[model samples]
Target: MHLTVLSRSPAIYTTRRLVEAARERGHRPRVVDPLEVELGLGERPALYHRHRRFPRTDVVVPRIGLSVTQYGLAVVNQFELLGVPSINGAKGIAASRNKMRCLQTLARKGVQVPNTVMASDASKLRQLVKHVGGVPVLVKLLSSSDKGGVMICETLESLEAALEAILGLGQNILVQQYLRGQDLRALVVGGRVVAAMRRRARVGRFARSLAQGAKFERAGLAPAQERAALETARIVGLDVCAVDLLDADGAPLVFEVNSSPGIRDAEEVCGVDVAAEVIAWAEARFEAPPRARATAARRVPREA
Candidate 1:
């Protein structure tokens, strides 16, 4: 099988690992920068890269980054038009990128998520804060990656300042209830929890991103936590994803569902070849019979 990985660079940790894993499994693998792909439309849609027609591909694994989401998704959509199946489809990727949409989809499917609210008017900022449980609430851009667009407002003054800066840039934001508990991430592949980790924020910090000097370690998930992670992926229509949740009290409250989750840290901490698991799932999916594939598609719950 010829597997194509949609990534900006082959040197990226996850992308490189996937390429190696595919080769190890006896499949030809190639990395294509989505930005370099030319989409052709006519009687039959086609794609070209480097002034040549794109070669035949059996399946695509998208490692789309937040910075190139729009063009990246377009490239993925073009592959779909050409009758190529992607591990995570365009719709799923799009839904996951939009924080509000991802949470709404999961909540509608009966998954508990942090109380979140979004508004355009700054005049209602205080009300929004109260709605999400009050100050110390989380302020996040609707389309953020990691901790780049996240902020914890401990006071109304800080919240107002953060909102002004973000809204001034014309970016939508979400005000979410803050849960003081363990930050956990579960990597789901093919409806199963492949790996799990707990991210601890650095001293005096609120966001638990590795980029923010957070520490992570391999963690085991309870039955309920595992179920929530798997269900979040299925509801979002992603074949593989990472579900980030807070151990709110004794229950799991999902905060984010990452479509193109970075597997480097998870692999190191959990001692799992996450890239290989992802590739194996894609291979099995691609080789499934038509009836089986149809049934699998039907199993994905629709968003409200």
Candidate 2:
């Protein structure tokens, strides 16, 4: 099999680990920056890598970061349309990437989520916040991307200011009831919750995600919370996902579902062979759909 991995840092731990494992497993693997793939508009969309012809690919593993998704998913989607397998399909990636959309889907799936309201209309801002309820409110950009752009406002003046700042981009802002308590980051792969960590803000931070400077340690969650993580991924149509849960009075609230979930945090804290496991899972999933052209080894199946 031949694999093309789309990631920003081919040298990064997770990328390197997965690439090496692919070679060890006797697959031809190429690491390509998705941005480098040129896209053109036409009757039939197409992609081309500059100065190089791409070999047939069996699957594309995307470690797409928020910075890259704008152009990255185009390439990944090309692979999908061309009948190449993707660890997480384009719709799954896009749905999970947008914070607001992710939560809406989770809620529709009967998953408990933070009381969230979205509004961009200057007239509706106050009404939206009222729906969320409380003096202190959290405002998150639906597309915060990095583990950031989330504002915790403790006063009415600050909350209003935060809402204005977030809405300045001309898109709706997600106003959520701030869940105050412990935080859980659950990494799920192959429809299973592989790891979970409890995080305490480093004295001043509000979110348990490392992006908030929270210190973390491995912790066990109630079976309900664990099930929530797995179900979130399943409902989101993901092969792998990072589901962030907030434990407020032992009830877990799904805050985020990340498709290109970071492996470093999960691996460092949980000691899981995340890269190897992801690669092996891809291999197993590939077998799920039988092939017309079969290769014993060292071959890229002709373009499907």
Candidate 3:
């Protein structure tokens, strides 16, 4: 099978691991920056790489960065038009990339999430924060990734200032109830929770971000949390993703569903062959609908 990985940083661990995994499985793989892939539209939609028409692709693994999400998704859509399947489809990526929309979708699907509220009117910012159970609130931009636009405000004055800064930049924000507890990053592939880890923030830090000196360790998830992660992935239309859960008082609340989650963290902490599993899933997924190939065992059984 011929596979293509859509990514900007091919030298990165995740991209390199995926390339190696695919080659080990006897599949031809190449990593291409999505920004460089050119699209041709008309009666015949097509994609070109470096001025040359791309060859037939059996599967595409999109690791679209937030910076080029729109263009990356357009490239993926072109592949879909050519009948090539992607691990996480373009629609899924779009949905997951928009933090505000993702949270609203999950809540509408009866999934547990942080108490979140978004306000387009800056005048209502205070009320929005209050609606999410008051100050000491968590604020995040709708399209921020990797903790780029996240902050915590402990006082009303701070909250107002934060809102002013965000609104000044012409970005929308979501104010969420500050759920304080351990952070669980659950990696779900093909509708299953493959691995989970507890992300511990650095001393005196409340943000459990992998980029901010947070360390990961293997962790066990309760049955409900496992189910929630799986369901969240399904709802977001992601075949492979990482669902972030906050263990707030023994209850798990979904905070984010990342369509293009890094596999390195899960691999490093859990010792799981994440890249290999992804390649295997892609191989099987190329042959049939993902749902048809998915097994019942991937789901946690419900007790009567």
Q: Which candidate's lDDT is highest?
A: 1
Summarize candidate 3's per-residue lDDT along 66-155 as a digit string, tens digits: 888889999988877766778999999999988888888998999989888886665677888879888666777765654667776656
Best-to-worst ranking by lDDT: 1, 3, 2
C-alpha lDDT (0 to 100) for residue 303 of candidate 1: 20
What TM-score would every model get versus the actual structure?
A: 0.87, 0.82, 0.85
In model 2, which residue pairs have backbone atoms overlapping below 3 Å? none
Tell me which residue pairs clash in candidate 3: none
* Per-model lDDT: 0.80, 0.74, 0.80
Q: Looking at model 3, which ten-residue stretch has the lowest summed lDDT?
A: 295-304
Q: Which has the greatest TM-score?
A: 1
lDDT of 3: 0.80
Q: Which pairs of residues collide in model 1?
A: none
Please give, for residues 183-211, the per-residue lDDT of candidate 1 as tens digits.
Answer: 79999998889999987654432332234
lDDT of 2 by residue, 1-304 (tens): 7778898878988888889889888887888888777665477545567634455677789988888787777877777766667899888998888778778878888999987887666346667777977745566665556656666654567656665565557655777776544668898888878888876654332322235655668888799999899899889889988888888787889887889877887788888878777888788766743543243111333333
Q: How close is candidate 2 to the true structure, as a TM-score?
A: 0.82
Give the runs in model 2 whose Cα sits over 4 Å from its true position.
24-26, 39-47, 121-130, 135-137, 143-146, 153-171, 203-210, 288-290, 293-304
